[model samples]
Target: MTLRDFALMVVVCLIWASSNVVSKYVVSHLGVPPLFFAGVRFVLVALATAPWLMPAPKPLWRILAVGVLMGAGNFALLFIGLKTATPSSAAIVSQIGAPLTAVMSFLMLGETMNRRRIFGVSLTALGVILVMWDPRGFHASMGLLFVLAAAFLGSLGAVMMKQMDGVKPLQFQAWVGFSSAVPLLIASALFEPGAIEPAAAAGWRFAAAVGFSAIVVSVAAHTAYYGLIQRYEANLVSPLTLMTPLFTIGMGVLFMHDPFGPRMALGTIVALAGVLIVALRFNQLVSLVLAMRPRAQ
Candidate 1:
């Protein structure tokens, strides 16, 4: 991990974090339809990365499935959630994807779950519950529920991706863009009638947001992150991504005026801590977890 690479990773995290705020603004504030917004973003992503689609990965069916799950399914739900969920709370809730991936791996990939991982998973769930707690009950936080579902789909896609081979980041992005765009566009047309009107009203702002999200965040930042993954160890790179939600929470406060009371703060800390635990490798994780336990006399 050179200092430059670390800086690059931080930049990548910032880009990703800003995306939440951007999406929230476009959907919640600008009034763009969520499915329509996601569909257009993927359409642009597909065009940009279309060249990489060649020499397509095998098991095309699985690739398509992963694409829809990670790309359209995940982001469509996220945008929908952002319609009502603040970026700050949504960011904290999204951290559940890390532990969800771990659990999915255990269930689908025959992976082992040690004490640390189990504890981490439990903590993550607890944190999400705390963050989602509403005195007004579930109806008030329906958006967060959608976000949770999105996280589950994304985690499932990640677990499925582990079985894939020879799929470069750009190539994967290309497939995801193409596969996700079709269904999303169709769904938007069907369910969100006159979706284009709001986008038209938004004009260049909408185009700019979608372009930034598609090209810069999805294509460029993700490709750079994947390059780092190839260069560095996964455990090292993975934990650093926790910076994303922190950045999102900060940006949400500064830009969106999102409320951040004590409960939200505590939930963020606990959720991020759990994700950090889940991201750690076996040796480091065991040592940390063991240290936390009371010493026997």
Candidate 2:
């Protein structure tokens, strides 16, 4: 990667990482309803990216569908989890999406999963199970289950995105911003009456959090991620995304003061290790590492 790519990746990682802290605050501090906040955030994102939607080509519909999974289902479930689960735990649980996606692709798309990927999926699933079982310092086991549901939806979206075409990354983000708003609004209306009034009452802090989510995190960070995919191989970009949860864990501890108990830590490590193993092709992984090693003078 060039310097610019490297810098962009760093920025994306930070923005995505901060999402956990911001989300925790929005749910815990501002008392915003999760589905309501997701709807509002995407509405802001749609407005922010409205110019791109006018042309609305046919290819965009599939993209929009994928966005609904990512933006609406993934986030709605995540927000539900956040209402009861801690930021750190949510981050760890949500990562199950990666391995889940791999397994789904193998089953649905007729893609083959080698031994390494299979092992990786098993480890990651076990890790998630461990984390779910512990619930040590965190509250709401049911909430964690909701977050896992969100991760599954996200994995489905990821798989769908692979089959999609003609949509740029930014365009994808914009459509998601647009499509995600509808379901979220519907859910909010049904489940979270008086949602907007409370958000308005909460004032700019709430607004700012929503704005950052829409503009900075959803729009900018995702744009960079798609951009990276354009520049590098999918395998390379995919593994690096692991950094996102790691960063989220850090932000949760430092910014949100989420407690990191032994169980959570161990679970995270085990889960991440599983994901890493699955993500990297064993022979290719060895070659890549050897290539990266410094040579003797």
Candidate 3:
């Protein structure tokens, strides 16, 4: 990749990472209901991208399943978890998705995993466990569990997505938006009484968060990342995106005032290393390094 491409990728990671900080503020400071906030964000995304909703992806049921798992199931858990969870812990724990996917694919699709992969998987789990032992409190542990559940759902959705066809990035977002929005809105209304009014009263914090998550993070940043993935090897793109979590942890400490210490750092390092192993082949790693180097004379 060229310098410009590298910069674009960095920007993408920042946009993605900053979302955690934004969401933490929205749920903790503004006191928005997690599910309701997620519902509203998707409502806007669905409206904005409604054009792609038509000519629905073939095997409509599969698309719907992906939407539910990737959209409603994952975000509902994540945002709820964020209500109590620090952004830093959320960042580290979410990395478990790579190993979770390996497990899911092995069980669901009969894919094979070698010993190295199994060790990486185990390492990922242990790292998450270590993070959960934080001295902060039990609520943080519960929040960690919620985010872990979200990670599981996301991994399962990724496996399902592999089975899908004819779903463009924007089109997939359209499906996720439409499929997730209604049920979430319904659930939020039923369970989170008075959620909407508070969002309206919260003023710019709520609106800014919604716009940033729905449009900038999901629509713009995700699409840009997908474009890079399409142009480059998956391994190359995957490792670079790890910057998102790293930055999220930093932003959590800097902006959200999330507590960070050796425990969090150790857990993050272990979890990310495992994710890196799961995501990249040795050859791809070398290629990625070469791609980053300046051309020789």
Candidate 4:
């Protein structure tokens, strides 16, 4: 990758990480209902990518399912989780998606995981246990369950994503936007009475959060990240993107004042290492270790 590509990758990571902090503020601090916020954000995304909605592409039902599972189920749960969960912890827990995707791929697509990936799954489970080892008990931390559910739904979306064809970048966003928005809007209305007026009057920070998420993170950052994926090997791209959780932790602490303890620190290290293992191809990983070894004289 060139310096420009590296910089773009950094920008994408930063945007994604920062969006978590912003979402926490919007949903929790501002007291805007979580599903409502998600609905409005998707509205912005839908408008911005409206042109892509025109074509009735092949595998239309799959596209709609992917959109609902990913854009709606994933974000709705994540936003609800953020209401109680810290951004830093949410970021780490959400990474369970990688392992979940591996499992889904194996079952649905008949893909096989190597021994390294199996080890990676074990490591990820250990890391999660460490991270969630609150003396108070994890059952009370229902927020973690919500995030994990989101990760599972997202993994399903990824598996279904493999089935679709001829979907462009903006078009994918279009499907996600439309499919997620309507359901979330209905949910918000059914559950959150008198929400709209307060949210509308919440002023600029709320609007700013929505804009940053819909335009910056969902649109600009995703486009750049996807471009990098197109250009680079998946193994290389996946590991580098791990910077997102680290960046999220940093933003959470610095901006959102989220706590970071010893267990969380260790868990972050272990989980990220496991994800790296899962992401890299077995042969590529072995080659990387060999290359890094000291050369004989």
Candidate 5:
């Protein structure tokens, strides 16, 4: 990747990290119904990207399936999980998606992973197990499980996306928005009784959070990310996103007053280390090292 693309990836990570915190606030703090919040956010995304929906990409069913899996299925579960899961922990657990994506790519996309990558995947799983471990047992486990399921859905969608063609970022976002919004809204109405009132009571804060999530996160950050995914291998792009959990942990502590005990810290380090190892090819690692060295004087 060019330096410019690297910087852009960093920016996207920040946007995604910020979005996690904001979503946590909306669902956990503001008491917005998770499905409702997710539905509305995607509704706005659909409206914003509606223009790009035209000349709809071929294999319409695949596009819709990807939209439902990555967009609605992922966020719906994630928001629901966030109602109980802390932003920091949720962020860490979400990293499981990288390994999941790697596995899926290997199985579905004909990608090959050597023993090093396999070890990295195992290490990542161990770290996530540490993070998900709670002495209290089931209290937080259910929420984390939900997040794990969300990651599975998202990873599957991403791998499926790799098989697709001619789907621009905005166009993909448009389909995701539209396809996700309808089902999410319907589910919210059916399951989350009195969901709308609390969101209405949240007033402008709710509006602002949804707007930021829809416009900045789903549209700008995710669109840029999709473009990068198109331009590079998934493993190459996935490692850089480790920055997101770091940013989330900081913001969660500073803004949301999230607890950061030694266990969580260690888990974060281990998990990130594993993900970094899994995602970086030896050549990429060498390049990164070379890039960090002093330039010719």
Candidate 6:
């Protein structure tokens, strides 16, 4: 990668990783309902990109649909997961989306899943189960399940996006922001009832989170991510994104001061390893390395 691309990757990582810590802040300090927070974030994002929303979506609506699932549904669920789950745990669960996408492609798109991919996916699921099964607290249940749901929706959206063409990332994000916010607001209203009032009472701290989430996390991070996609193949780019969780785990530990017990540590490793296997089989790794290696004289 060029220096420019490398720096962009770091920026992408920072934006993606910072989201976990910021979401934790919104939930813990502002006491905003997770879905409501997400709604606010997407609404801001939509407004920011409103000028671009015109222009024919046409067949591109299919691609925009994926963005909705990924941007709104995935984020909404992830925030809710964080409400009761640790940032580290939520990071790990979100990684499950990669493996889930692979499984989904095989089922929905009729893609062939080699044995390595299958094994990797299976291990990934097992790791998630172990991490979620925290003999105490809300483990193996709401906290874990919500994050997993986030992963599933995100993965599904990714798969759908892959099949479409011609939609720019910014355009896609704008549509996603609009599509996602409505459902999120409805869900927040029904479930949390007082969601908006508390956020209003809290004021700027909550407002800052919404701003950061929309401008920095969504726009900046995703723009960098899309730039990377322009330079690299999806397979190459996607696997490295797994690193986001690691960064998230670190942020959770250092900034949030969330627990980093042996269980969480072990679970993270196992889950990451599984996701790697599923997403980047040994053969793919070998091919990538060989491609990058200098040719012999």
Ranking by lDDT: 1, 5, 3, 4, 2, 6
Regions more than 4 Å wrong, model 2: 54-61, 135-139, 287-297
Q: Write the per-residue lDDT of candidate 4 for residues 1-297, one digit (tens) a residue.
A: 799999989988999999989999888899999999999999999999898897966777898899999999999999999999989999998888998899789989999978988999888878876776688887766887788899999999989998887777888889899899999999999998877876888888788889999999898888788889889987778878898999999999998888899999999989887887898877877876797899989
Q: What is the C-alpha RMSD of each candidate to the true structure, in Å?
A: 3.8, 2.4, 2.5, 2.2, 2.4, 3.3
Give the TM-score (vs. native) of candidate 2.
0.92
Clashes of 5: 0
Candidate 6 lDDT, tens digit per residue, 104-190? 899889998999888888888877876787777553458768889988899899898778777787887788887888888888889
Candidate 2 on 1-297: residue-level lDDT in tens?
A: 788887778779888888888887898778998989999999988888887876674776667778899899999989878887887888888888888998889877888888888888889988887778843443447889999999998988888887876767666777888899988999899999988887888899998999999889988888878888888988777777778888888888888788787878888999988887877878868876798899999
Clashing pairs in 1: none
Higher-scoring candidate on TM-score, 1 or 5: 1
Candidate 5: Cα lDDT at 295: 95
271 Cα displacement, candidate 1 (Å): 0.6
Across 227-293, the per-residue lDDT of candidate 5 in tens digits comes to: 8998989877877888899999999999999899988888888888778878897787788779879
Lowest lDDT 10-mer window, candidate 2? 132-141
Write one digit per residue (lDDT tens) for candidate 3, span 1-297: 778888999999999899999988898889999999999999988987899898988799999999999999999999999988999899889989989999899998889887777888888888888887857666548998999999999999999998887788899899999999999999998999999888998998899999999999888998899999898878778878889999998999998888888888889888887777778776765776698799979
Residue-level lDDT of model 1, residues 1-297, one tens digit each, is: 899999999999999999999999999999999999999999999999999998878899899999999999999999999999999899999999999999999999999899989999999888998899887787888999999999999999999999999999999999999999999999999999999999999999999999999999999999999999999989989988999999999999999999999888888889988898888967877775797799989
Cα lDDT, model 3, residue 32: 94
lDDT of 5 at 145: 89
Worst 10 residues of 1 by lDDT: 280-289
Q: After superposition, which runs of candidate 1 have C-alpha atoms over 4 Å from their true positions?
A: 282-297
Q: What is the C-alpha local distance difference test score of each model?
A: 0.95, 0.84, 0.89, 0.88, 0.91, 0.82
Residue 190 Cα positional deviation in candidate 3, in Å, after optimal superposition: 1.1
* Model 6 lDDT on a 0 to 1 scale: 0.82
Candidate 4: worst-modelled 10 consecutive residues by lDDT: 124-133
Clash count, candidate 3: 0
- Give the TM-score of each candidate: 0.95, 0.92, 0.94, 0.95, 0.92, 0.90
Alpha carbon lDDT at 94, candidate 3? 93
